[model samples]
Target: MKEVKKMAQKCFPLNDVDYLAEDLRLFHAGRTVGVMQVTGNDFHTVAGAGMQTIVGKGVAYLLTQIDGLGGVVYANTDNVVFNHDVADALFNRYDAIIIRYDKETNACALKLIKGTPSSEPTKYIPKRSETEYELVIKYVYIVAGVGTITNSDIKDAILNEELCGIAVDTLAKIPTKQYDDQMKSWISNSQADFKKWFDDIKNQLTEDAAGNLQNQINSLNNKVNDLKDIFVVMEEDSYIPPEERKIGRLYFNTTDRVESGFNNEIRVSPNMGLKKV
Candidate 1:
């Protein structure tokens, strides 16, 4: 199921025109978050920044000019007196400024100040926010008729799109069937090589097994004979039946006491001699 995003929240209000210049000073040269049209009859609108537009005519045209100028516009309403502090605020906060157009005077002027300009990328995060280009359209409509969304709203929209695209692109990079096929081919070749090595080892072991057993048995027999002195030797004269001399059986005694019954015992003989059944 698709999840619904929370409703948009604004970090700053865009409706208040009084702080527009101050906000621009801080955020500077970005798209307008919201649009405010000075509608009071007392407002004697005059151009304050980069370019000018007639105060009462239409906001769309003014926004277009601001877009072209690539800055925020601060036009005074007829009701308010122009404050130098406002001008200073705009200069500090925004890159370019437009004064309200006076149709009667036919004058729209731009204010210029000296400072190092900000990098374009920093000025507007192209992927994260609306470009100066897009804001013009959004602002003009907001100024003229349709109310515009806040700057925070616009930023949220951009962020949402960016996140979605990143997810999709990352998903696309996952390994596919083609990669699995290549891996399988490698594994098959490795298994074949391993099987050949195992077979060669088995053959070698089979060929050596008989010789290995014979060598081991001979070594054990030698070890038993080395300890023959410890056994009792019976002379022919001591034989119970006065047997003639030929060979004497050497007997060994064991003092081992078994607490458990023996399951089995192994008997060995010299090479070529038969083993006890």
Candidate 2:
């Protein structure tokens, strides 16, 4: 008689032995939580700071992107609009603009977290916790005598996937040997296959809207070129460690969204992303 080894919950051709809920939760738990550009609408859309209102595109902040979701109840995303006053000379200080998710209230909204006044003169960012997952979008520095906030006054605070050890496409490129057929199809398809997939999804949608979104990809104008335009940043300057840089991995840099010269065999890019049935 020979001894046999048992497999994990996510084995392919999942059946009675596999707990689908547990598998999904485990999958979602393995990734970092942050705002992700899911619908090809906006990646980091945000603008404004004044007595008037600021504008930002709707955001998706959940494991549903880089990680699998345990379950989805209902999530309706929309653009963000905020109003803040830049302190005029008298009360110059640092502040943080954040998107906060409160588990207790089941609410996700934008908030301005105030920082200590005149403390070493640095940008302000809010604290994050298990219950209150705050994604800091921008750090603001209110200058004395200036009531206006400019690009120079704002700094990006979006969670960096590199720093978090969770690339945006990490889940997309997981070992397909263990994933179900759909996951394998998503991960293993080439651009030509991807174009067909894109066309299929588009066909299911209303022609006018589908045409627009499909055109958005076909034209390669609106959406970020996640698959095609290889990020050209030098690997030496990347924050990723040398050992972590592996072939067949897609790398993203805020400045340069390029692959780190790793994958020469096969280029795997995330899907163009499909919405409701």
Candidate 3:
């Protein structure tokens, strides 16, 4: 007994095991390509003429759970133009948008393969082959008489896997604001949420033993007011009022008038009287 192994950096299958193709594509494109092309919703279909199903931009190695071997191939380079016209008055049927990979040539391309006509939509069989690996990206249900196919008629097959996903950021998904008639911008939806950041900073400063900025400014003003007690000033001639003469107090006394201006004497009170320096 031997264990089956797939090659590293590539997928491989051993001969004598009629499961060659299936084994090779088991992890083809690594189960999910993760929505490679962002443009036009990644291979989405648009409602159009009954005979024509428009597939939007598609570029990825696509697959589905049921497409064991044929579920691994590169899809169309761009939007697909393919006809899935009514063969007759169809009761109902499913059509697959597949990426066909020809192993012999190692070339991959897109194709719209008609599924087995089914009265029950769930019973429709999509394309699957060994040589030409047909990876079904989507299952499109053809409405009666081939009416316009909308998004509802198409079954997105990517989400079949746990990591299978599609993400095309649309303006509708975003919260935006129009700046003016000719301009637009994104803005905060609520003022409280926007102002919470500044409020948090102010609150943190109070808890950290560092007073808030407003408190600091008020403290500074108090300290400036206390400076009045440090020194008292007298601006006059040498005659100073007896009560005004105090130690460390300074006086600017006029000496004489000069060409520039009146000269002043600098005197400091040493005792109860002012002494000229």
Candidate 4:
């Protein structure tokens, strides 16, 4: 006798097949959610199925994985794991993940998820979130009579609080005495070189050499002026006492001279203001 053949069970019933297909298409198209606005530490939207849960848990996960240079993180629906080596590959592989930021925004945005590339619906777009981008602070000190000071030369000046235009918080972040000796040695050498250049200019020995010396002097002078422009002393009216100040605050102190007691006392002032709370 022939045995009866068994039919395999279908994943979905005939009526539900269309709905499942549509949902699958939506997932494949990456139409999971709209633009996610990250304002500070909070996620704006708590609606949608997977999105709501991801927003609540994944945001914190994204923040932790952010590197100093900044980048996007990816995860499966169930697990949010950020591995730098695999972020790009996983980002492309996953369908329902959010993107943190891109190079255009200076890696500032909180939610940079891939979607259908449509304008976010008015109802879904949250109020603009205030996000803070990580900044790389650099200190450039300009000396008037002396040539441009090296980063090493400015270390002591920075630590002593002699450099005015720099924010106090920025100053606090610097490694104290990291460049003190190096900067001092550089200043000594630079002064000696300046004297030699000055003598060459005054002697008027060879036109070409003198011209070159003069050009060097001119370049130095321009750098000094540029430094002056950058380090504008905070006006007395805007001064916030140190005790009450926050990070990224820009204030000027008239008393703090750039190269104090030097023949060319270039007064360093704070400018561009600070980014504080």
**Clashing pairs for predicted structure model 2, backbone only:** 58-78, 58-79, 89-145, 231-257, 231-258
Q: 137-251, model 1: which lDDT tens digit per residue?
A: 1111011121222222111111122121111122234555689999999999999999999898888777887679789999999978865633444444543222432244334
Compute the lDDT for candidate 1: 0.33
Q: What are the per-residue Cα lDDT tens digits for candidate 3 across 159-257?
A: 443223442222223322333422422234345566897688767877763656678889888878766644444555446665666665444444422
- Among these predictions, the greatest lDDT belongs to 3
lDDT value, residue 277 of candidate 3: 35
Instruction: Give the lDDT ranking, best first.
Output: 3, 2, 4, 1
lDDT of 3 at 137: 63
In candidate 3, stretches whose alpha carbon ends up further than 4 angstroms from where it belongs are 1-40, 62-75, 123-130, 162-277
After superposition, the stretches of candidate 2 with alpha carbons farther than 4 Å from their true spots are: 1-27, 39-49, 62-77, 86-91, 159-277
**Model 4 RMSD, rounded to 1 decimal:** 34.6
Which prediction has more favorable lDDT, 1 or 4? 4
In every candidate, how many clashes are there?
Answer: 23, 5, 0, 11
Alpha-carbon shift of residue 203 in model 1 (angstroms): 0.9
- State the displacement of the C-alpha of residue 39, model 2, in Å, after optimal TM-score superposition: 5.8
Per-residue lDDT for 81 in model 1? 22
lDDT (Cα, tens digit) per residue for candidate 2, span 84-167: 565655556766776655666867667777655563555544444555545566666766677566666665556554212122
- The candidate, 1 or 3, that scores higher on lDDT is 3
lDDT of 4 at 272: 26
Candidate with the larger lDDT of 2 and 3: 3
Query: What lDDT is obtained when candidate 4 is compared to the true structure?
Result: 0.34
Q: Given candidate 4, what's the lDDT at residue 87?
A: 22
